[model samples]
Target: MTNSKVGHRIEELTTPAFLLDLVKVKSNCQGMLETCKAMGVSLRAQTKTHKTVEGAVLQTGGSRKGIVTSTIDECEFYADHGFDDILYGYPLIAHHMPRISALTRRLEKFHVMVDSKLAVETLIASQPPTGKTWSVFLKVDCGNNRAGVWWEDEESIILAHQLGSYSSLITFRGLYVHCGNSYYAKTDVEVEKVRDENIERLLNFVDRVKERGVTCETIGIGSTPSCKKPSDNMKKLDELHPGNYVFLDVQQSTLGSCIVDEIACRVATRIIGHYPKRNQMLIDCGFTGLTKQGEGMLVTGYGIIRDNPNLKICNMTQEIGYIEPLKGKLDFEKYPVGSLLFIFPWHSCATAAMHSVYYVIEEDKVVAEWKPTRGW
Candidate 1:
């Protein structure tokens, strides 16, 4: 049944609405889940990309568990929805401990990540209620250099030992790393290469920690690009967490992680004006709608027009997106004022974050509305 509240047809919805293709979303989830199963790893579906209970349910295949969130709000949102096992995959903030402690008391298993002594110390300082010990993972910087202690650094081992020493307040769960560098790779081979290198470094870190007599229970690693086209060499890793695979964007497509057809989310907008002499068309979608993210290899524009990839969103203001022809001339009559268009975002995660709700579409009809948990 079509969701009457949001409108049945995509065109009927208000301009600058986020759209999620139900079929594509399910396929992406199933494909990644199968990939993890084949690689002998568990899929800890990252909810950071689509911070909605419905999307998380689909990503987890109705298990309503094994999730990785970027914020405490997401953790609380999912936990309230009966998602018991969750890993807050960000460096622990001392100020957020009160809420974290409250969540830990209720959840069956709520884990957090720490890359420094301060984070570990903070976790130790903030003790949960009785019978509650925080499950924690050491964020190891495999190669991305974004967060986490470097894999080769002895500090990781030191921190593991420190976390272990405070066994009553914290449990040193395992190691976690994000291969963010894979997003910069221009080809599938390079993406797989990054994945292999990241896994190798992660395993090396695990071994070094084990040599010190500490048993790392869960070795979690993944980025959407790496997991979508994982290297066959991935073995021994206990879990995989890839967020963007839920709704691949132009960036993933350009990186060869997923084909253009696999992009599941887009901004549905309407043409507001046309400038024939300037060869540009104005749309109601803007930075707040499509986001200003683009691929490293091609500076196509803010987003790719779903029907006409040649039309680039060259510039955008708060609510106005300027679409100009990247190649050849623009036909004004083809996209007159009020004409609706679907624009596949450059980065689905950022683009989706701009909207509060997604008009869930299946067979070109709105079947449901997914409300995302927003804010820090």
Candidate 2:
């Protein structure tokens, strides 16, 4: 963002807009890429967070492929734009296998998740071309209790080895685990422990499988909170996928992942009205635009106001926000009506996904703008 361009864009645009600092965005992107380089693993970033092609490109380093999507529509959109090697990363519902088979036809390598006999049977019945390999990974439950097989369950253990039988069409990729508990870590020290423990358990699972000559071809592990604090533990995995680092949100900040300066995206709103008597103010930005996420009883608001830390967006209605001024604080002389303010969301990915386009800023100025790809 430049000084002149900031003025130009401010004049050209209306309030309640999405602002993106490319400088900060680039830095955030580079930090995660560097972490992957140091870990000696392939980075197949999860795109469910950003849900944008521009956001995806910034994190791609040089390659425009080998990414993960959360939805079938997202997979089709990315593949249409020449992005191959996509892993849906979610559970394989039996009814969705037909659509999944169609996606396999569009990519060089398409990976799916399998954790049940029903899912496996449906996948076998709906197979794609023999020329392009269809790969499947068993989602391991590393004590997350999520949608995955227990690491030591006899059924899961037997299924892991049985996958080798579909040698002609479906190939066993490896064990896939999402260490969701990593987010519970309070400090960087604790976060590193979570990372190490996740790697230890998953690698132990790998060793357990290798005992039967059923070596995992791809060992995958990730969680944004886990990757935020890098560790030597990552060396055990073949690939790492972390998505939310592209836009550092307040949630990441609360988790101690990154600071406000590292935050690349924000919501720009104007002070529409003031209530000096009630010690509050109103802004045009609301849940419809800013996204109702990353805030709760503790946060107690939609987002954090960058200029005023003590001020609380305590109350929010359809088209207004009540800015609770600190006790006995009534100083709207400095903040007047129509003043543009920046807000950092609790979840960067969720907030940014709702935005239509982003104004690229540099040095506190808007210099460029980029539209984001939105939808499932």
Per-prediction count of colliding residue pairs? 0, 3
Q: Locate the minimum summed-lDDT window of 10 residues in model 1.
A: 291-300
Index of the highest-lDDT prediction:
1
| Candidate 1 residue lDDT tens string, 85-185 | 99888898888888888888898899888989898878877767899789999898878989999888787788887877777888888889899999878
What ranges in model 2 sit over 4 Å off? 1-8, 297-300, 364-368
Superposition error at 193 for model 1 (Å): 1.5
| Residues 1-376 of candidate 2: C-alpha lDDT, one tens digit per residue | 6423344555345767788888888888888888889989888888877666776777787577888887877788778777788888888987777778788876788899887777777666765765765688888887677778887777777778777777776788998888787777677777777778778888888888887678799997888888887777677778888888888788777778888778888888888888877787888888766777755623447788887777777766766777876556858887799887788888777776667667777656677766656654
By summed lDDT, the worst window of 10 consecutive residues in model 2 runs over: 2-11
Over 4 Å off, model 1: 1-7, 295-299
